[model samples]
Target: MNILIVYAHPEPNSLNGFLKDLAVETLSAAGHEVIVSDLYEKNFKAVADRNDFTELNNPEKLNYIQEQYHASKNRTFTSDILEEQDHLLWADIAIFQFPIWWTESPAILKGWFDRVLAYNFAYGPGHYDQGNLRGKKAMLSITHGASSLANYGAYGLKGDLDERLFNIQHEKLFFCGMDVIEPFIFHSSTKEDAKEGLFNDYRKKLLNISNEPVIPFHPLSHYEKGQLKDQYKTSIQQELEMS
Candidate 1:
């Protein structure tokens, strides 16, 4: 499988970096092609602006969505954005590896999504199940500075991790038609004592990731006027309850 690892950690020796490297090594050893986009190393631009487009469709007004749609159609996106978009299109599985900051991905990674998931490419009318990334997969490989048992959802101090990631997994990846693989989250990642064991488990997880569980995101058809159909409601509720 073709895998693209979009990594965002400032330090090369950090935990996120180690896991990113491990993923590349493990997947490549397993005969899967892998590519890593070390955002910080690349010095990636973290904010979207008019410069995103090579030539302006309307220079006066900076309507990002409008420009993205036109730029995607005209192939007028700047080189950096275009390059990442190409990688995104080429990948069968896209893994995002980063250390959680303020309950979210670092600014650079978010910028990647902002500029790379161009309109008319990643999302538009007839998106969701029919979106451009319909057959692709997305997985979050994240590290957080909190204890798994204490901060892990299901009535934990931080509520639910699943809920925290709903916008990303559901609104972003799923909305773009990518089936999200269950996230691989490491809690208290700064604990040096747990690093070796966690690394071992992470390597094993990467090797066996294809068999891991995928979150149940009902298809667009399962909704009626933007809500779950009556017949699907019970099952959806049951799944949420079980989670």
Candidate 2:
């Protein structure tokens, strides 16, 4: 499978960098075509603005979303954005390798999503499960500075790690119709001894990408008029109903 690794760490010697390298090496050794987008090295612009388009839909009004949609229709995205989008289109799987900052990906990576995943292409009407990226898969390879226990259940300082990543896994990747794989998190990433184990686990995950269970997401069929079917209300919603 073709794999695109969108790497966002600034330091090449960082743990996130090692994993990114390992992914490219391991996937390539397995005969999969691997492309790495080193955002920092490339000096990728993290801001989405008028510079993203060669021509604007409304030169007077700077509505980014409408401009993106119009540019997509006209094939007027800037070269950098078009190139990244093309890579996304070519890949069967996309891996995001980044260190969590303020409980989210770095601004550059977020901006990459804003610019590269054009409105008409990555999403629009009949989106989510019906999005343009339907058959592709996405995985998050994240490194967290906090310990695993600290990011765990009720007593932990931070809530569930999954909850922290919901915006990226659910809102972004899943919104684009990519089958989301459970994120591989390396907690307490500063520890040196964990490197070998982390590398091994990551290698296994990469090699078994086809077998990895996808995170369950409500399909388009489960929604009627933009709301989930009554039978599909999550447990939280059910609890609220009881209250």
lDDT of each: 0.87, 0.88
For 1-243, candidate 2 gives per-residue lDDT tens digits of 989999999999988888898898888998999999999998999999999999998899899999989988988999999999999999999999999899899999999998998899798864778888999999999988876556556667877778888899988998988999888888754467867887799899988987898888788788899898897787534555778
Full-model lDDT, candidate 1: 0.87
Evaluated at residue 4, the lDDT of candidate 2 is 94
Model 2: pairs clashing at backbone N, Cα or C within 3 Å? none
Residue-by-residue lDDT tens digits, candidate 1, 72-151: 89999999999999999999999999987888889999999899987898988657888889989999999888756567
Candidate 1 residue 197 C-alpha distance from true site, Å:
3.2
**Best-fitting candidate, measured by TM-score?**
1
TM-score of each: 0.92, 0.92
